[model samples]
Target: MATRPSSLESGRIHHQLGKPRGLLVSPICTSRKMSSKGPCRRGHSSSDSPCVENATLVPTSVRTHSENSSLIASSIGATEVVSQQPISSNVENLAVSRMEAIGQSLSARGISQQVSSVILSSWRHGTNAQFNSAWNRWSRWCVQRQVDPVRAPLADILEFLHILFQQGLQYRTINVYRSAISSAHVPVEGAPVGQHSLVSRFFKGIFNIRPPQPKYCTTWDTGKVLRYILSLPRNRELSLRLMTLKTAMLVALVTAGRCSSLIALDLQFMQKTKTAFVFTLVKPTKCSAASKTAKKVTLTHYPPDSKLCVVKALEVYLQRTKPARGQGKDKLTSLFLSFVKPVHAVVSATIARWLRTIMASSGIDVSHYRAHSTRGAATSAAARAGVSTAQILKAADWSSESTFTRFYRRDVTTSEFQTAVLASVKR
Candidate 1:
C-alpha cells in the first residue's frame, strides 16, 4: 500500500495546494525537501523554504510525467544545437567560395603575364621602340578625351582617325595609328579595331581618296662614290674615324649588307681565308629567318696593286684600330666602335648618319638619298656587270625578284630596249 498510496495521496492533496501552479515538482524532489537531507544543487540549506517554495509537489505516479516533460525539454535543446550546425556549414561554404574566386583571379593574371611576355619577345628591337611610341600617342589621346583606351568604342576610334588625318599624318602613319589602337584593344578587351565595319569602311575611303605615293631614295652611284673614296690619301696622319668610315663604305658596298645587320658584325665572326675573307652573320637578316644556318659573305681579294680592294681596306682598318679582346667578352665588342670618348657600339642610325657624311664629303647632294641606297647601288652595279640575275639575287639574299625590280633595279632595261630598237630598224 505504501508503494501504491502515491496516486490517491496526490488526488487528496491536490485541493490542499489549491491550483498546481509554477514549476512541477516530482515526488523524489518533494521527498528530498521534506527530509532533512544535504543541500540542494543550488547550494541552499533544507531549512530554507524559499528554495522549495517555487516548486510544487506531486505524487510518484505523476513523477514519471514530470520526468517525461523534462526529457522533452532536453530533446528540444539538442534539436536547437543540431539546427545551428547548418549555419556554421553555410559560413564555411561562403569562405571556401571566396578562396576559390581569388585563386581563379590569380591564375588568370599569371596567364595574361605569360602571353604579354611572348608577344613582346617576338618583336624586333627597332619595331618595339616604334610600337611603344605609337601606343604612347594613342594613350595620351585617350587621356585627353577622358575615355578608356582598352574598351574604346568604334566612334572614338573614328574620331581619333579624323584627328590624325586633319593633322596631316601620312597614309602609312595613319595605318600605324590604327595598328596601335587595335593592339591596345585586343587580348584584354577581346575587341580589335580592324573588326569594326565603320573603321574598315573609313580606311577604304581614305585609301581611295589618297593613293599611296611611291617613295624612292635617289640611287648612289657606286662607281663614282668608290673612286672618290679611294682617291683619299692613305697616310698615318689619317684619323681612325676616317679609316672606320672608309672600311664601312667598302664592306657595305661589297657585301650589299643591310644597315641593321652591319651593326651586329663582330670581329669573332670574321675569318681570313687563303684567297679571301668570310664574314658570318650571327643573327638572321630581315629577309632570312633560319637561325640554324646563318648566311656568310665571301669577299675575294683584288690585285695587290689596287688600293680599292675590300680585303685590303679591311686589313688596313684592323691594323690601325686596337685589337678587340678575344670573343664574347662585352656588348661593346662589335666590329664597329664609335669615335667618341669611352667608345660604344654603334647602332643602325649611327651607321646611316656615317654613310650620309661620306656622301657629303664626296661632294654628292644626299638630300634625296637614304643609306639603303648603297644596297641598291651595289646590287644594280652587279646586275649591269653581266653577273647573272640569279647570282645577284643570291648575293643580296633576296627570296623574291619583285623587291629587286621594285627598289634595287631602278636603272632602265637597256638590253631589252636596244634589241627592240634594232629589230624595228631592220624591219
Candidate 2:
C-alpha cells in the first residue's frame, strides 16, 4: 500500500502509512577490498583509484540503511543518494580497511633489536646512548653463516655452538656467543609469533646446557712457564733471548695485563716513585665504559715491574735494539717499541708467537696456556707472594669467576698455622 515514482500515476504519489509492501528500488552497494594506498574521501572511493589528498574531507556524520533492497540510501545534495553493495560485502570491506590502518601503525620498525633497545633506554634517560659496535660484527657474522639474527632459531645456534667448539674456540668464547643471544622473550599466551619476542622462548632450557668450562688450568705455574721459555731452541743470541723471555714472563706473570695493555707498554706508565709500573689495563676508546671518568675509566693494575729482574731485562732490551722507523714515537720510550713500520709498537700476535717459541724452547708442557697464560701466571704468583686470595681477587680484577679462589690459592703452610702446646702436658 506504499509506493513512489510510478509510471501509472504521473501526477500523484502513493504512500501507505504503515503497510509492509513489495515496492523495491534501491541501488546495489558492494564491498571492495581496500586499496593499498588508503581509504578514499566521499568524492573518491575505496577502489584502486588513487586518492586525491587535496579533495575536501568528508563529514563522517552521514550514513543510512536501506530496507527496500541491499543498498543503503541517504539524502545528499537534496536528492536521494544510494550506496552499491552486497550488505555483508560492504561491511567486510570497511572492516578490512580499518584493520590495515591499525596494523601499519603498530608493526615493527626495521631497526635491529639491540639498537631498538638502546633507543628505548636512551629515551627513558632523556639522552642518547651509544649503540654497541659489537652488534654490527655479530650481525655480519650471522649473515655470513646464513642465519637471520632477527629470526635466529635455537637449532641454528646449537649447530653454531658445535662449529665454534670444532674451530678451537674455548668455552669462554662460546659463552660470549650464548650471551649475545641470551635475552629471552617474555611470552604472552597465544600471542602471534612475530608479534612477541622469541629470545626467552628459544632458550627454554638453555641454562641446562652447561657452557663447556675451559680446560682446568692448573698447569701454568711459574715453573711451567719458565720451563716452556727455556725449552725454545737456543740460538747464538740465546743469553739475550733468555734474559728477555725471563723478564717478560716475570712481568706478565706478576702483572697479568691484557694483551693490548701489555703491548701498549711504555716508560710513561713506569712509576719510579712507587717502584712499580702503573699499567692501564683498559683497552683505549673501545668500550662505552670509557665515559665514566679519566683515570677512573681506565683500568690500572700495577705489577711489581721495579724488581731487578724486570728493570734489568727492560734496560737491556732497550739498549740493544734500534728501530728502522717511527723515531718520533720511540724517541723517549725504551720499554716497548713505540712504533713499527719504521718505528716500534709491539703486537698481539708477536707476543703470542714469542711465547710459543719460548714455550717450545723451554720444553714446558702447559696445555692450557696461551697469551692469557700471562694473566694466569701473574694471578698464581700473587697467590704465592703472601697475598690473601681475597686481595688477589681485587688485584687481578677477577671477581667474575667461581674459581678465582681456586686459582689464587698458594700453598697453605701448616707450620704458619701451628699453635704452641704450652698447657697440654699437665694432664
Best by TM-score: 1
Task: Please give the CA lDDT of all the candidate structures.
Answer: 0.52, 0.35
The ten-residue window of minimal lDDT in model 2 covers: 71-80
Q: In terms of lDDT, which candidate is strongest? A: 1
Model 1 C-alpha lDDT per residue in residues 1-427, reported as the tens digit of each score: 0000001000000101122123222221223232243211222222221110000001122222123222212211110000011112211211112112223334445756555555546656654454444554454334223334444567666876766565444455567557655644533334457656777788887878775443453354454455466578773445888878877876777767778878867767888976577778886556557544687777666563245566777777666656433345554457777877677778888898888788778654677666767777667666654556666677777778877777676552344335445655665
Per residue, candidate 2 scores C-alpha lDDT tens digits across 62-129 of 21111100100000000001112222332223221211222222234355555554544422110111
